[model samples]
Target: MTSARRWASVAAMLFALLLAATVIPDGQVFACTPTRVWDGDGPIWCREGMHVRLAGIAAREMDGSCRPGQPCPEASALAARDALVNLLGGAQGRTSTGHILVDGPTMRCLSTGNARGNRTGAWCAAPSFGDLSCAMIRTGTVLRWDRYAHGRCRSR
Candidate 1:
């Protein structure tokens, strides 16, 4: 191969390696300091760059709609979102994209091998809230998704 071609190939390989390094494997346990929240059942942006969707629960979408078969809670979208932000230590501010910056404590999350778009489905535990999934359910802001919950909510 020409010198230029060799350099391009090496660069491509390095880029692939970098992407793989950021991919969290199924069932991996990771810690994330949540910096922003999209809604109650999150796509919470972490300081580490991992986006987490709270596993075992469903909340109203930001547009105030719940996808057909998901547990549609009685709570409004803003209600649910605000409740989650409060649980995370309250909203620090809002981003240009409309996500609320949160002052939540660092949380240890267990990935459940599920993905929704780019976010990982995780069961996370915050210091103030032992289990976020259960806490959301208890607040009536979200509902337990039994398929993903796997009886964890029952015990809690």
Candidate 2:
């Protein structure tokens, strides 16, 4: 084969390898169990699978208007709570043991794992009221929740 063609082939192989590594690598993989299911905003929940898009949500939160001290507005919190409840309907009361892709500032809720309801109503941060810019996630979609802790949910 011509030298130029060989180099092109090698480059293509390397790119393919890189892509595979990003998707799945030799490491721990957790299967998420979505006891509850919601079609509203926030991270999507699945019946059984791990979450993978934590970074993307975190990035959006950082870039959004919500600041560190300021929790999500009331409306946002209610919406999230409603969505969560809708998902949790008829399921066990205890919060499911699984990693959730959440915004860094909103990480407090995930960390607490409180099933009492919305952040303000419970112990987590409250959602922004009347503000639709709240962190929104696709419901029911599953991804790798924790990447570094060997199938364990990462703490914020």
Candidate 3:
């Protein structure tokens, strides 16, 4: 890693630690049980084992790296994912553990359009987690996929 990025990472970690002290307590549950599964970054992965380029939906690469020109640091990315896990009460949803309803799409909103139905992709939601995409946005852990999802990335 470049010295700049290394420093950035260290700084980000410190910030995340601070945030954890204030925002993330130690009692969060993490029993996500996705019916299917996706990877951990740049897009939403459904339990069905499909990758969806959902607009405004994203997760940081599990490597915990940083994005070019993005202010969020590398540690922040990982921290965001961790935060989402806490929100979801697990890695997926806490359906088996009894924290999520698991009956509908995750909380999604766009300033200019409807979800456009099955073309966008799929996500799971529980009451506590709300929507994963929104959670990523809230935590700044994932990339802003609107540029990719809204354009030509076909659902795969």
Q: Pick the candidate with the highest lDDT.
A: 1
What is candidate 3's lDDT per residue for 60-147, written digit by digit as tens?
4455554564333344544654555455444545434333222223433222222332222433345655655555555655555655
Worst 10 residues of 3 by lDDT: 23-32
Report the error of model 3 at residue 101, Å: 18
RMSD per model, one decimal: 4.5, 17.4, 17.6
Model 2: CA > 4 A from native: 1-33, 36-40, 52-79, 87-91, 96-156
- Candidate 2 TM-score to native: 0.23
Best-first order by TM-score: 1, 3, 2
Q: Candidate 3 has which clashing residue pairs, if any?
A: 30-90, 31-90, 32-90, 32-91, 32-92, 36-47, 36-48, 37-47, 107-131
**Clashing residue pair totals per candidate (backbone < 3 A):** 0, 21, 9
lDDT (Cα, tens digit) per residue for candidate 1, span 1-156: 999999999999997655433535679999978899999998888777678888999999999899998889999989989989998999999999999999689999998855656677898997789998899899988888988898888853
lDDT at residue 134 of model 2 (Cα atoms): 25
Tens-digit lDDT track of model 2 for 1-156 = 999999999999997655323321223333333333222233334332222222212111322334353233323433443444443332344345432323221222222222122211111122331111122333322222222123332224
Task: List the global CA lDDT of all models.
Answer: 0.86, 0.31, 0.42
Reference-based lDDT, residue 74, model 3: 41
